[model samples]
Target: AENARLRAREAGSLAELEAMVAAFDGCALKRTAKQLAFADGNPEADIMLVGEAPGAEEDRAGRPFVGRAGQLLDRMLASIGLDRSRVYIANVVPWRPPGNRTPTPQEVAICLPFTLRQIELCAPRFLVTLGAPATQTLLGLKEGIKRTRGRWVEYPGLVRPARALPMLHPAYLLRQPIDKRLAWRDLRLLRRALDEEPPR
Candidate 1:
């Protein structure tokens, strides 16, 4: 498994990484998934958003964040004057887990390399991990979303270090609409970060 991850990490380009993930058979989720939801949006964007896994809509469309959650995500991005076109979006687990259930630890472990490599290839200046799985998986943290959201940390896993922020998933906001305020606060913080003038 480590060798596979190493190979993926060494991929020279985003296209190669995508191809590797598509051909990867180490994870079982791929067998049940309709297609590989590799990523969406501009690969060269400065902001990269990582989600937990592909939902039904995402699996069907072979893109991340295309369901009701995706709609909310779009609105959230719009609030900050950004959109999918300005950000790269992918998932920790590119395939959809059965019954829309949370992916098992083993599944995440097997698929981790592809996502890490995707990030390295995209090399975004800002990284946002949506939901707990994505936050923990990419940021290497154990805290839950309630404790981790709205905080800023540096992700060292990428080819170059990046400022990372964790936030509530849009699906969670859909279920608990009141928590949208917290998400709103996080979005504002992100906007401020993006708007900040880079140090000379």
Candidate 2:
């Protein structure tokens, strides 16, 4: 009964939600962005991946995860029997921050709710936060992604009850190839979680 209600709330059809988000004008990043790179992928997938903010490539392409870092993410998902086509992907801040610096708290504040609503819209079984900012925002923790990645944590306060698996972002991976191995391990962990069935 509870599960059925949850599905109803997160039912397919992000049209209304997307429309609402498109009209949002709180975040300052929106002022300087080319376009709102809302989200890209299967809306009903079991996994939702969230990044921090759009970079040059994302701003120009109007899509998250399209640059070199995104390429690495594509390859990572493919390595684990998954791809963007089968998962939900988006950023906390849809627009690129000027100079590509970390978003200010106020910027994240306005946009975080948008992404949260997005999670409600996508309704993924699990959330894979893709960087320090993403992880910290979702989990409300001050710990670094290194201290938190690859572990499953229940998020009851979120719109949907879901598990979170924080991981190093692909952008970071490009900066540190040796860290790619760590991301690979997190992917394996995600695969294992996906293979499990909910307890009845």
The model with the greatest TM-score is 1
- Residues 47-166 of candidate 2: C-alpha lDDT, one tens digit per residue: 899998888988998888888888999999998999877898988788899988998877787666666667876768888999999888888867988888888887664565889889
Model 2 quality (TM-score): 0.89
What lDDT would candidate 2 get against the real structure? Answer: 0.81
Against the unseen true structure, what C-alpha lDDT does each candidate score? 0.90, 0.81
Cα lDDT of model 1 by residue, 1-200, tens digit: 68568789668999888888888888899999999999999999989999888989998999999999999999999999999889999998999999999998888888887778889889998999999999988887788898999999999876668899999999999999999999999999999988893622
In candidate 1, which residue ranges exceed 4 Å CA deviation?
none
TM-scores, one per candidate: 0.96, 0.89
**Each model's Cα RMSD:** 1.4, 5.4
